[model samples]
Target: MRSRRGVIEVNTAQIREVADGVPDVCIYELLYNENIEVIEDQCLSKRKCDSAILASDGTVGIFVKPDLPEEYRQFLLWHEYGHFKLHYDENMHFNFYLSRFSWKTEREANTFAALNLLKGEDIYDQNVIALLISKGVPERIAVKTYESLI
Candidate 1:
């Protein structure tokens, strides 16, 4: 099910290959390599929102809340990159209120982040899911991670 941004075609095989090649793939480094700028900001105080992506003059800027935990912040970075990769067009400025964005858009981004960050690991394993949940992965994300691996 694709959203209005269009179908986000994620090649899990290619992502796996890249993950295998890189020692430690940092999402920020990946964004940098793609010429996307990342800014850590503490000004986004909206509940349930930790990041935003702005596209202008052919450049994508990702702003992440700096006050979140390291793991959560990393997740947010990946989520925003998902938006950049999947939803953003060179002419589209994606900044909008969280309440205004469709749930499908949010779900797509969350699924993208879960799959990419987890690297198609078998997060469905109950023990592994529990471990991830205990380690601060949101329950929704844990479920999405499991679903993506399938």
Candidate 2:
């Protein structure tokens, strides 16, 4: 599916809106309806990336480093999905050795992932990291994303 493009000024609330569009969890199941193909690549992390997306020919593909634990793999998939939904510039590179992704963009993706993963949870009343862990978010990312959110 084509992204809502030209939105370079996205915020956490905006990401929340995007997550609201998704009716439920199990992103792996949702991607098919979104016309996104998922691929498990053993070499992804060898390239210095946990996950990445490739958009082409009216289909978006999310490639993940399968070596990661299942929870982290799911988180990475959501993160890349955030990129696809938000800043989906076709020219978005693989983020080369000389050109890392912008910090803000990465953070936005993580925020989207966290928001979506914990959509039905009461983040205000619980330990955020523990909550995220229960929902399959990695402890490190859960901690950092929780910290960033607060």
Say which candidate scores most in TM-score. 2
RMSD of each: 4.5, 4.1
Candidate 1: which pairs clash?
none
Residues 19-123 of candidate 2 have per-residue lDDT tens digits of: 788778588888877889889988775787778888886678999877678877788888889988877766654442233446767788888898888877766
List, residue by residue over 30-141, the lDDT tens digit for candidate 1: 8878888888877776646678888777877888877678877777777777766656666444443543555656666666666566654565545755655654468877
Question: What's the CA error at residue 69 for candidate 1, in Å?
Answer: 0.9
Local distance difference test, candidate 2: 0.77
Write down the TM-score of every candidate: 0.69, 0.80
Error of 2 at 65 (Å): 1.3
Per-model C-alpha lDDT, please?
Answer: 0.64, 0.77
Query: Model 1: what TM-score?
Result: 0.69
**What lDDT score goes with residue 42 in model 1?**
71
The worst-scoring run of ten residues by lDDT in candidate 1 lies at 14-23
